[model samples]
Target: MNPAEPLPRAGYADVRIIAASPDIARRVADVLRRCFDSTEQRSYPAGHDGGTRLQLTVDTAHPAGPARSWLAASQPQRADRPQGSEA
Candidate 1:
């Protein structure tokens, strides 16, 4: 199947995780699976380099956990930062 083909259902998205090794690629995909319902990942060679690419379809409408939890927890509070300072 063509990787560029559109997903069959609404709220479904195609995702590709690329890394230097298969284990690293799979670890990133696993993080997404924790946040959303996803299909089995397909592995592929990224290029002439020894990199790995993994592709899968995730259901955005059906989140396995709070999608924004990690983001929210990691962001610093506005009051804790110096006013008018550039990040």
Candidate 2:
């Protein structure tokens, strides 16, 4: 699919991941697959860079686990005290 084209709405997203190798690109896609329902990855050459590009569609509405949990897990906790509470 053309990268310039607009993707469909309603939880559907067009994901394009570029990496130095096909295995790296597919590895990234695999991580997404573990979180969301997605289509098979389509591989392509990334211009003169000789890198690999992977494209796929993912349905965010149907996440494999509780939505936003991953986001929370990735957040960094404050190093300071708990605010108004004892350290």
Candidate 3:
């Protein structure tokens, strides 16, 4: 699913990301925070030697319009960073 799209205004949604490394996982979580009104529900080392795992929850019942707007505005700045730089 497109991360930029707004979530439904009902129930709850969960997102899980497994990054190549802990740093990438953290960066992804930060970017997700900018795009959604979500809470960092859990974070832990993945089993089977996988990278860090991050889980986030979005309560669609809550307002998220402002966060979406901010995400749109910040995309340009985020894109300008060097490919491997920290988020």
Candidate 4:
């Protein structure tokens, strides 16, 4: 994914993982959290056989533009003042 490309500002992205064991599923979830800043939305048993299922949701937001533009837009500039005096 290109960093400069505009991303979807709304809706949730679902990520599902199936692992041989609960511990492995949890480990995968941990990696997803670190990579995408997401959290586990839910978890369950995979089926009659032994395994685990994990789901994670990533909430989308509009990208803030380049750093310099964001900073300029967010900060208010002070008015120029006379050299000698405080108002």
Model 3 TM-score, all chains together: 0.52
Comparing 1 and 4 by lDDT, which wins?
1
Count the clashes in each prediction.
0, 0, 0, 0
Candidate no. 1 TM-score:
0.69
The residue pairs found clashing in candidate 2 are none
lDDT by residue for model 1 (4-76), tens: 8655689888898889999999999989999988999999999889999899999877766567576467767
Candidate 3: which stretches are off by over 4 Å?
Answer: 1-11, 60-87
List, residue by residue over 5-50, the lDDT tens digit for candidate 4: 5554455466778988988988877765654546545889898889
Ranking by TM-score: 2, 1, 3, 4
The model with the greater TM-score, 1 or 4, is 1
**Per-model CA lDDT versus the true structure:** 0.85, 0.85, 0.71, 0.66
Residue 48, model 2: lDDT of 88
Error of 2 at 4 (Å): 6.0
**How high is each candidate's TM-score?**
0.69, 0.69, 0.52, 0.51
lDDT of 1: 0.85
